[model samples]
Target: MTYGYIGSMRTRSGRRDDVVAILLSAAGSLRELGCRSYVVGLAADDPDTIVVTEVWESKEHHDASLRSPGAKEAIAAAMPMLTGEFTSRETTVVGGLGV
Candidate 1:
């Protein structure tokens, strides 16, 4: 079974783009660590919100990715721009298009 994770974060005003860039900076590294899919989305109605949907080979892979140097750097760069509000869910991916 694959591991799926969806996370939504609220960025400080005018900081969404910067935070999004920071997150994307590590996308390549994540792929090398077993990420199957990684998508970043912005809410059209809420400019400050960022939604990240990811599928990993397993829960262990997902967890390990977070500990990677690139991931750690991205988190450090984006944290200050965030509003401390977040929503996240973990799931077992069964089947899906492009997944």
Candidate 2:
């Protein structure tokens, strides 16, 4: 089954742009690891909020991708700008626009 991850991340004040750039720059690496899509979006009214949506080939693929060197590096690169906690949801893709 396909796997999906949707999450909201809050960056330090004025740091959302930095976080988005890091995610965008790392997209190619994630795609190579079986990530079908990794999209980053900015919140319309919250400058510090970022929305992340991801689709992976499978749960295993997504988990394994996090273990890849590239993923670890990407996480580390974005860590500094992150603030507070993140909210995430995991789902099984039954049918959807991108599925």
Candidate 3:
């Protein structure tokens, strides 16, 4: 079964865009690591929040991607900009359009 992950992070004051950029910088490389889809979104009413949605070939693929250098670098770069507040959920992707 495909693995799906939905998560959100709260960035420090004015750092949401920066964190988003860092996350996107690794988007191109994620596919090579088995990612099927990766989407980033901002809340209309929350300037400090960033939401990320991802689908992977499997749970193992998702796990491996986190250990990737690009992912690690992105995380390191964005950590300081975040408020340490987050929301996340892992799901089994049954079927979906574009996914």
Candidate 4:
């Protein structure tokens, strides 16, 4: 099944730029890993909060990318900028529903 992931993160004090840079690098790495779509956007009302949304061709592809060295390294680099625990959720696309 096609897979999607949503991740939410909050940046530490004075780390918004660092976090954004990390996310940009991570997005590029995810694209190289065959992600169908990847987006990292900051919350308009809260500059410290970031939301990362990604879609993969399949669950297997997503899982494999998560286990890749590049992904791990990117995550590690982003960790220090985090203010609190990140939250993530994975889901399978059931229907487009013509949004």
Best by TM-score: 3
Which prediction has more favorable lDDT, 3 or 4?
A: 3
How much RMSD separates candidate 2 from the native structure? 1.2
- Give me the runs in candidate 2 sitting further than 4 Å from their true place: none
Clashing pairs in 1: none
lDDT-best of 1 and 2? 1
lDDT of 4 by residue, 40-76 (tens): 8888987788988888888888889979987788778
lDDT of 2 by residue, 1-99 (tens): 889999999999888888888888878777778888788999898889999999999989999988888778889988988986799999987776765
lDDT of 3 by residue, 37-59 (tens): 99999988899999999999999
**Model 2: lowest-lDDT 10 consecutive positions:** 90-99
lDDT, candidates in the order shown: 0.92, 0.87, 0.92, 0.80
Candidate 1 per-residue C-alpha lDDT over 3-99 given as tens digits, one digit per residue, 9 for 90 to 100: 9999999999999999988888788778789999999999888989999999999999999988988888889889999999999999999998988
Residue 2 of model 2 has an lDDT of 86
* Cα deviation of 63, candidate 2, in Å: 0.8
RMSD to the true structure for each prediction, in A, is: 0.8, 1.2, 0.7, 2.7
Error of model 4, residue 26, in angstroms = 3.0
Model 2 residue 71 lDDT score: 74
Listed in order, each prediction's TM-score against the native is 0.96, 0.91, 0.97, 0.81
In candidate 1, how many Å is residue 73 off? Answer: 0.8
Residue 52 local lDDT, model 2: 93
